[model samples]
Target: MSPTDILRLLLKNWKLLLAVPLALGGSLFYFTRHEAKSYASETTIYTGIASGYSLTGNSESDYFRTSNAFDNLLSLIKSRETKEQAACYLLASHLQLKELDATQLSWASLSRMRALLPAALRRQLTGPTLAATQRNVTAYASANDTNELYRLLNSHDPVYSVEALGKVNATRINSSDLIKLELETEDAAICRATLALTTQVFLAEYRSLRMSQTAAVIRYYEVESEKALKRLNDAEEKFLVFNRDNNIINYYEQTKYIAGEREYLYSDINKIEMQYAGALASLAAVDKKLAGRGASLLSSAELLRQRKHLESLNTEIANQQLFARQQETDAAPRTQQLQVQAAETVLAIRTTLNDHYAQLNSVEGIPSKGLLDEWVKNMLEATENKAKLEVMGRRKGEFMAEYHKMAPLGAMLKRIEREIDLTQKTYFALFTSLNDSKASQQNNELTTNLKIVAPPFLPSQDKGGKRLMLVAGGAFGGFFFVAATLLGMGLLDKSLRMPAVAQAQTGLPVLGLLPAHPTHPFKKTKKPAQASKLRDHSYEHAAAEHLARQVLRRVSAVPARPFVAGVLSPLRQEGKTTVVQSLAHSCNAGGLPTLALYPEGTDAGPANDYTRYYSPAQATLHRWNLAELTQPRAADVQLVLIEFPALLEATYPVTLFPELSLVLLTLKASRSWKPTDQQAVADLRAATAAPVEIVLCGVARYDSTDLIIPIEKSKTA
Candidate 1:
């Protein structure tokens, strides 16, 4: 449907639009007029759990040195135990009453009993200091002899629970240290008191928890430090005992001494080895000389005596020659004689030595001096050298034995020294670690990081107003309800209510349209003439005039005599007769000669009168048979609008269409158009060669383009 048709539909049903909104909105506003007022209070605290001071070194570091502290604090803040305690605190401060004689307590009774408590006791019982008195009072009406009512209040349930925690909200602010606690309740004072109580209770719990956790951490450090200290002491004792067992004041120093001695012994052994080699070489040389001396040649006692005498004579002669050469007289006779005597003694000694060998016949003549010391004096010197060489060889052999024996001690000394160094390092490391742990434990005992910043204060404003919200919500809901209903009804209603729809559905042109005119539904007992006079013309007149002009445009196309049009609908009471009545009046008013006829109605006044109307129809109208309609029409009649019984109701309806030049299918525009209407149009189009056109009657008044004025709903009906 077009925008114009929708507007007309709304305008025609103006009562529905007005009634739905007024009924829904008015009823909502009235019932919700006295809604409960609420007041909200807020308090804020910051968690020190995320950041803290370093007690050990005081550089503002993470003192707890743990991952769980921050998480634990957040859980503690929102835990059920905390909420229950907060609720108890609130009750103790604000609603403490005498024992409940009844299952439920009244405010008046509470107020009366509240005066009996001492001021100090009341002050002490509120906030973080809530006493055992509150526990007993709250437990009075509890189901299991526990304060389950206060617990109920602290639950997250929307109803049947205490709303202290239910109405309260706790949350951490984004990217900040602050935690916010908000409480909203119907009673302003109660909400304010609850806010104070909850924050105080939370702080109290926080302080206690912090103390306990800190103490636990300190105790752990102390125990660990003690263990480390004990380990250090044991290490020191082990080191001391090792030194004692080794019989050394300092193992490290003793190891250095032993190392120095071992190095000295190694140097001495090296010198002795060189000396021993030299001694061995000297002994070999001495042995060679002894072999040449032929000690065996001197083995005989007689030879030994001769050799001794010769040695004496040679020494005396050598002394006399050395004395003569030292004399001042160069050519002295004595010097010459001494030289001659020395030569003579040397020759005699050799001759005697050779004679002895010759007498023994045991030696051959000796080789030259290069191969042997041929002088008797030189041979005796060689014999003495061999004796000294043998004594030195024996001494070297003893020293070598000692060098080999001390070689393994150097390795044993090095091993002992390494072990002593390692023991000292272990003791030092343990002592240092133990000291650090002790300092940490001490610092933990001395430091505390948690501190409260602010307490809860009274709220400045109450809760949100309900009346405006209710009114706005009701209007919105009512609008949606009406829209949904329109949608549902439109989905169910298949009738063609608009001209555009009828044309689109039937595939026929709507030549013209007349707004629906509900006949004077009020005059139940009126005669035909009286009812006709009473019918209103505001919508009907304007609709008929517009439709008749449109119909004439098509009728004028034929330019034939007796221009006759039949008006029909598929259903009874679809305003076919109304369309004809208004159409003829409209034609006559437009200066066209017109006659309106109802082919089957007996209610046309005065038998032959076509100008007089019956009970419900307005305008001069007449009834005719198919014979009268086909046989003759007034010579003055330029247009004749014939109204037929509805197609579904008419018997012999085919005979009524013989003289028609055009067929106008009239239907109420406000009513749903049925499938039968399309069939009826199809039938009429098939039955005659006349052009079939639809004229929708009773369009509503909504726009300047809408051709029909809307008829008002009866005020009484």
Candidate 2:
């Protein structure tokens, strides 16, 4: 079929196609309104390190290495711990636990508990059907008792699903970082509360874990202080034992030993004391020193000499303290080393002192022996006690040196210790607080990390009420459906829908078109009103007639005469007779002399219906019995259009219309001309021995131009 024909068909059946989408869309829109409204609430979570420390070195570097803050936060949102908390919160607040308990009570007992027991029991129970015993009981009730209870017992009952608004339903949505949470409860306040509570608990739990690292640091310092204190005590005890072993007391023996063993140390101390006296003397000697030779004595080199002398004196004092320790342990290595070294050097000096003493003793003529011994004993005992005191005094000096060192470090140590102690206490206290917080928070709930950016709210108005969607969708679907239907119709249609196909089928020059009318042929009218009718009473019926008459009017240009136009079809029932009648009617109506020669072999020919108009239509209607054509009856007639059926019996009767212009007739979208029908038209035209112009009949309404092809215009002679 031509595309226009296909479009026309779609236009014709548009309503049916439109009906499907309209019905479906309307039903959908209507049902959607009745659907229950859903509400949603959400909370956001931000997980992070709560520790505020920014320490340096290995400790600071290692802190972030093992911590998986991002991953742990992700896990926290999906954890069953969170879900269980959520479930418990929802169940306690929204679920129908109380109603469940109510349901557990026996129905009979519940009915009996109320004063309306018998009446309630009758309503709760449904009478059975299809049982003889039950039917008998029902019949007895109907006959004997006509009360409300009787009716209730007999009536078939319906059980309704409880309308509990507190049921909770959880739904998770599509974001990985966020959860689209929803609870099914009628109360909007409850939904918001549930979400809020869940979030609070989760934060409590999350913050407790946040400070764990800081708590660990505080605990470590407490452990180190105990170890340092123990080490200090052990060192002090060993030092005390060494002091007791040596019989040493004061610094006097230490000073004597210092003077005898190192003479330069004593010489240096005497020189320092002398310089103090000299500096006083130099108070008046500056003017004398101002002279060239005296200036040399006050030069930097001279000052260095004096400073070295003063440093030697301080060294001598330090040696005196060491000497006291050695006096008690004279036989010990510390003492023996000092004595051996000093004795070797001082032996020469002692020999000289002894010679001087021996000379004195000789001059005194040898004192008594016990008096010398007693004097030596007194000196030795006094020296021993002095050495013991010196030993004690040196130890005290050592302690004082250590105290000086410790004094500076002591403040630092105490500060560190205090910090360590404070940190330890904070660690324990914070840990304990965390535990307490966790226990309380275990019952408390918090929102998950995922939160809905936009919670579902009760809309003030539904988006378009779905009606506009219904209409638009209906229109779109209907358009496609109609297009598809027309496409299918075009493919399956075997009848010639285009004028070209009709020409190809029968070798006819398509002359005209006739539209199909939905109205009866007699009831048709003009115009937009014409779209409603089943049949065309005016234009369509006259179309074929007008086409034939126009062909006859052009016969002078034809190459042959006794022109014959045959309205024909491949099938017997194709509307060929109707075309023939319409053709004859137009010619007759136009005042053209026309005779519809009805050949007798087939009752299906168009002239059979026109028999009443001709006086000799009945007698000469048989095959080879055209008495009117042979008679002198048509000399004045300008043209004649014949009705010849495509029959085998009529194929040989061509002599009556010799030198004839043969025109073949067909209807648009009607039965196509078969091969035999085509051959019959060709044989009749060829047998007439004439040039024939085939005429197509009844092309579709839009294709009148295609029905006729214009011949070339003649030039002026």
Candidate 3:
């Protein structure tokens, strides 16, 4: 359907569209009449989640972190625990009230609470002051989940419940750190009080939560720091014990001194060997001068004993110098004693050798005194050198042994030092982390910046109810809904509601349209004059006259004696009888002798001069011969309009097709064309060579006007 068709349909049902919306809107207004006026309270808070100064210094804002922070803040504000606490506080304040105070609660709300709370329970819970009442309420609420205070907070009551407090809305103002909180309730005092309490509770809870988080982190870092410190101390203690047990002080330095002393001792031994060799050679030459006497003197017991004693003292001093611990290096007295004993032994040996030489006489008996003196000095030098060589050799062996022992000690010491170094680094790292955590905790404390910029105030004026807006919305909504429903029905409808629609559906040219009229053309009425006036000026009469003229023009080409036009329909009640009667009247008025024939049961009231009902039995016997059926009126009739039974219900009389000049298919404008109707029309066309034109009856006035306009214009032209 076109938009024009839809517009026409809606306009035709304008009264229904108006009535439905008005009725729906009226009902809505009446039902919402008792809606109470609302009171609103708003508070603004400075929540520094995105841009805030802290002990940690200002940092660049992170979109994700700031978003998360705001999310957390909003979640905290809406949290059940926070609201419950606020509700508890509000309830405690109310409980402490001795009488209804406008500042605290409205009279109706106070009265409602009194009625809800038993007098005995109320007295038990109430206290002289707000603080005492809060304590009492807390204690009572904690006693059980089924307590009155608990139940009240959990219930859906509009004043003291957590659910009620959920109405408080917290939103960040644009991208700023400020938050706007709003709430509306039936009572102004309740609205203001709820918002105020909720803000306080949310701030306290947020601060506590932030502090707790930082505190937990600080505690963890502190624990790790303590562990790190203990590890460091343990490493140091191990090192200390290792040093004590190993008898070491500055192990590297002690080893270096030992190595230097060992090298010096080896060099001294080399020098002493050179001296002993030279002295021995000299002694040998002197001995050659004193031959057997020198040999006997060197073999003397005292001399041998002195030399052995000197070697023993030197060995002891060398051992002390080469192998003594660093702590033992302070034994200077003992070292000096050992060196003195060695020197004294060397002197005794020299004296004994001198005495032996002095008492000796040259075997050759030539300058014996000088020879003997030289021999004694050389003998003492050789003896002392030999003793030093022996001590130095032993010290070299001890030095090598000490060095080998210190190798493992060096590795162990390095391992211990490495442990201490690692532990020390760990300690410092944990200590730094602990300090950072402490700083963060301090920053959190400083940045708990929930400041109320605009505190909630009691609303004085009542915010009017939304009754008018709701009523208007309902009316508009109902109007749209009804319009949409009608449009959907129209789109889905397949009714041939217009002459164009009938022509399109049946693929037949429309002769004309017959507008729906209240007055039946065949029915006799008490007031004939009024009926005549109705038929004369009515659109239906004009449409019928036009349709009859079109049919006459088509049948004028037929060579039959009396032009027979068959009025047929797909189904009964398609106004086939009406069309036939109207066509006959139109023809008779136009000076054409017209005869109208219908089925036996048709309501063609008492046979008139131009109208008659035909017998089905005779028509069937005569094979629907128009001449045979209308033989009696054939002489007076120039145009015969025969109304056939619905073709879908009864078979078409193919015998009558040869006698008919034209066939008018009368289709109701409000009825859909079915497949059977199309098939019946096809069959009727095959049975006759006459032109089968469409006559749309019961058409809406607008559709009828559309069809009549062209005709009227053509006639005028």
Candidate 4:
């Protein structure tokens, strides 16, 4: 429909609209009457996640770690375990409040019991102080949130407490650490008190758990450090003892000493060999001359060895001298030291060789006794050389064995030193770790990083602006509710309420709108025949005259002559018979010779159902057989008003019509005609070529008396 059409409809329902809003106002007042005033408060807290943590690690981190840190904190806040603890604390507070309130209630109940006692007895039982205290406690409970406290404390189920915990809302703002937590309740004090206590419990638990974990780690590190220190000490002691047993300082220098000893032993053997050889030569000469006066003794192996050592030392000294001369003082210190040692060795070996040569040269030609002495001396010297050679050989073997041990002893010593070094490094590392752990533990012991930058305060305004919003919303809601009820009802209703509504529903032109006749409120409506027994009132008479003119005009517009219009409806009690009787009276009175006929075998019976009536020229009423209705009409009748039983309810064959014009008489201002009944009207139109118009009865009255006409008062009792 166009907006104009909607506006017109609303205009027509203006009075109903007014009535609807008033009804809504009354309903709102009732609903809001006993409701508690609500309050709300919010708190902001930075969870330190968005700010980033002061953790000991690489300072720069991934965005996921930075961003999702608050998400972890939010989980902590909303955790079921945390909420459970909050519930316990809140429940305890509720119990305490309930206890205090219960005392007052108990006193009040006692006072009431005392009041029922005799007056003198009541005076004896009651005390002024007790009564005043009771009144004050009761007032305190009433003014505070003690009613909810009482209920909570009295409840047997723990589920109530669990459900109560749901009141807290922990909201993260835009996935950041900025959290807005709120508690909503009828009482502001309860909200504030509960949030404060719960926050304390949560902080204490969270901090304690974190610190405890750090402490455990610190203890573990301390144990490890102690173990490492012990291993370091053991390794160091093992290395020291090993070196003492070997009679060594450093393995490298000890090896050099063993080599020097071997060289010296060989040099001594050479010297002894040189001296012994000289003696052996002298003995051989004596032995050869004994027949030529000669002695027969041999030189020792030691003398031969000494002679070779002396030559080697001399050669080594010469080589060192040549090297020293080339580089001079610029020679390496180690090389210079080697040159000096070689020179000393050369001097010792040369002196020993000269003494041995002198000993051999000093042996003179001997007399018999002197020669014998020389022989004995030569043998003795040879024997001494032999003993010295044996001793030198044994000493060289021992020195050689010691030299062979150098690598194994040095390896063992180096291994112990390495173990000591590694242990010490480990111990130091563990110590550093222990210190770091202690620092971390201390840091953890500090307050939790979550800081409530802004704590919640007692709310100044009621939550949600609920009262004003509800009132305004109720007004808004009432408007739509009223619209739906009125408009929806209007659309769903197929009954004729106005001539326009009747025409719109059936697509039939409305002939007239007739006002309802007044009647006693408690009296049931009489049957049509009984109703027709009474003379028509002035309103009915005027309505009949006004409607008849429209009907005749409508008939004139149609191609069919002398319209034989039947007053019909889909169902009974739609005033079809009444319209037929009235229209017949009006037309006949207006000098149109009209006959009104009720169809045969219908609920409309014979004369027994009719009241005797006469107009100056009334429409003849009949209940004719079907065959007679099909016969030729009488010459005097100019118009015919036929009445039928409800067409859809009864089986009226469509072919029964004989050139009939149909007037569908639908009741106005009633919800009587269903959409299903309109099809019956369509069926009637399909069956007959004559124009079908509708008469809408009992419309709402509007005074415009200019078009009304007087009707003849022709009724007789």
Model 2 quality (TM-score): 0.42
lDDT of 4 at 52: 44
What TM-score does candidate 1 get on C-alpha atoms?
Answer: 0.63
Model 4: CA > 4 A from native: 1-24, 27-199, 235-433, 445-554, 557-561, 578-594, 599-637, 651-656, 661-717
Best by TM-score: 3
Q: Which sequence of candidate numbers ranks them by TM-score, best first?
A: 3, 1, 4, 2
Model 3 spans with C-alpha error above 4 angstroms: 138-151, 227-231, 293-377, 397-408, 521-538, 555-561, 634-636, 651-653, 710-717
Looking at model 3, report the run of 10 residues with the lowest lDDT sum.
319-328
Per-residue accuracy of model 1 over 192-219 as CA lDDT, tens digit each = 6666666776667766665675566556
How far in Å is the alpha carbon of 170 misplaced in model 3?
1.3
Query: How many backbone overlaps does candidate 2 show?
Result: 28
Candidate 1 has its poorest 10 consecutive residues by lDDT at 612-621
> Residue by residue across 364-482, what tens digits does model 4's lDDT show?
44344445455545654564565556656666677778878776897788788888888888888889988988877765654255677888677666764355557666766887787
lDDT of 2 by residue, 359-406 (tens): 123223444232233333332233333443444445556545644544
Question: Arrange candidates by lDDT, highest first: which order?
Answer: 3, 4, 1, 2
